[model samples]
Target: MHYDVFNGDADGILALLQLRLAEPKETALITGVKRDISLVKQVDVGQATSVTVLDVSMEKNTGALSELLANDIPVFYVDHHRTGDIPESPLLTSLVNTSPDVCTSLLVNDYLKGKHHLWAIAAAYGDNLKKVAARHCVLNGVGSQLSTQLEALGTYVNYNGYGRTTDDLHYHPADLYQKLLAYEHPENLFSNKSSLFYDLESAYEQDMNMAQTAEVLFDNNICKVVCLDDAPWSRRVSGVFGNELANQSPDKAHGVLTRNLDHSYTVSVRAPLNNKQGADEVCIRFPTGGGRAGAAGINALPEEQIETFISVLQNYYD
Candidate 1:
């Protein structure tokens, strides 16, 4: 038996789809929404001859990954996360391509010899690598209008994964993947969801309006920080707010800290688009938190450190 594990977001699902479409095979799928990437540990090696892991961090899953390799089951890891020490086991084939400019789908496209280049652009768009997506679009004769649509679809689908729970999203990403896989072009997929997009755009507009009213806390001039305590709107709009703020003020680094049910807060960080340097250095201070220089997150922060965190952000600004 073979099993496929992937992040349940549009990028991960599209990467898996490209892989499957290039080479169809029977396999059990292991996936969950954006937050569930760490759940790859639950997969048992005893039940499969081979496993393909996509868009999940092997560094974070080092223990489970090492155990799987020790069991002599072949494992293939394809991802773009911050990596630690990777083992030399012959049973494991890891593709750790952590380029700030590209994404996992583009790496998979390279692996597949670019046989599905169009899909690769869609994945890149979904992952928010707009420049790369646009370059690929031009390379493949994808018109500007079509590229824009794919960009919107990709961004919206990725946004769907930011909900605090499945109930808050338009559809669970796995459910959305079913609809997505039914079409070849991302434009076609967007066509199927025109009504959904209209509704989502309106909701997004209202949400942004509310977010603009959030109190701003400047830890540093370069970094803009905001805190929302136990607000339902905060949980729903946290990620989107980060994106919107980053775009609206491209010169400043942005962070949004929202209280989770456990009283700790979740942190979303975004570096200015043009200069995404040094974001990772700040996040590595916490366990189970790391990402690209431009975008990163911390799963949880002790409530007590909230003030200290703000101070640190001020230091980053200086």
Candidate 2:
């Protein structure tokens, strides 16, 4: 038996689709929303001959990953997340590529020789790699209209992963993927299915609501910081707030912090649209975070350091 594990976001799903299409196989898929990164621990390794992990990082789930590898199950990982000690065994075939220039979807597209360029474009949009996505679309001969539609679907599904819990999403990402699978092209998706557009629009509205209600913990000429309490809505809203705020204040950076159920905080930090190079510096203070010049995040931060976290933001402004 084979099990395919991936992140439940647009990039992860698209990457898996590219792989499955390349090598059609009977396999069980393991995934959940963006927050459910620790899903590997729950899988019964003994039952599978191989595991293909996409989007999710092996470093983050080292214990479970080690367990799977120890059971003699071959593991194939494809991601652009941070890396740790990757086991050196013939049983493991890993393609862990972590770089600021590309996303997991694009990586897989390159791995598969660009046969599924449209799906790769969608994945790039979902990850906010607009320039890269546009360049690829142009090269692939995708017209402007189709490109925009694909971008919208990618953005919508990416936005749906924000809320702190599943309830905040207008539609669970898995269901959204099912809807996307129904159409062969983005034109058919938007033209033939009013329901898909409506659902995406509804999700966008709720995402805006969360953004509007975000508590202003810090406000300055160059930056704004907001904190959200743990809730399905907040989780789903976290990344969306950063994306929306960046658009709203092109000259100012936007930072969103979400409290997890365990009293920790997961931060989504974006540099000013005009100066996206500072995002990496902003996340450097956190032990478990790093990213490119324009965007970064700390996957988890202890609650007790809330004060310190705020202080770090102040440093960015100063």
Per-prediction TM-score: 0.89, 0.84
For residues 1-318, write the lDDT of model 2, one tens digit per residue. 888888877788778877776777878768777767776886787688889888886777888888888888888888876667887778787777665557888989989998777888988887777777899988999899888977876777777765555566666766665566554555666776566765775767775686687788888887788898777667776876687788788788777888877878888888776765667677767886665556677778887876676677667755
TM for candidate 1 is 0.89
Instruction: Tell me the RMSD of model 2 versus the true structure.
Output: 3.1
* Model 2 stretches astray by more than 4 angstroms: 195-197, 229-231, 247-253, 259-265, 271-304, 314-318
Per-residue alpha-carbon lDDT of model 1 for 213-269, expressed as tens digits?
777766455778897666655666776678777777877788898888898888878
Residue 5 displacement in candidate 1 (angstroms):
1.5
RMSD of every candidate to native, in Å, equals 2.4, 3.1
- Candidate 1 RMSD to the correct structure: 2.4
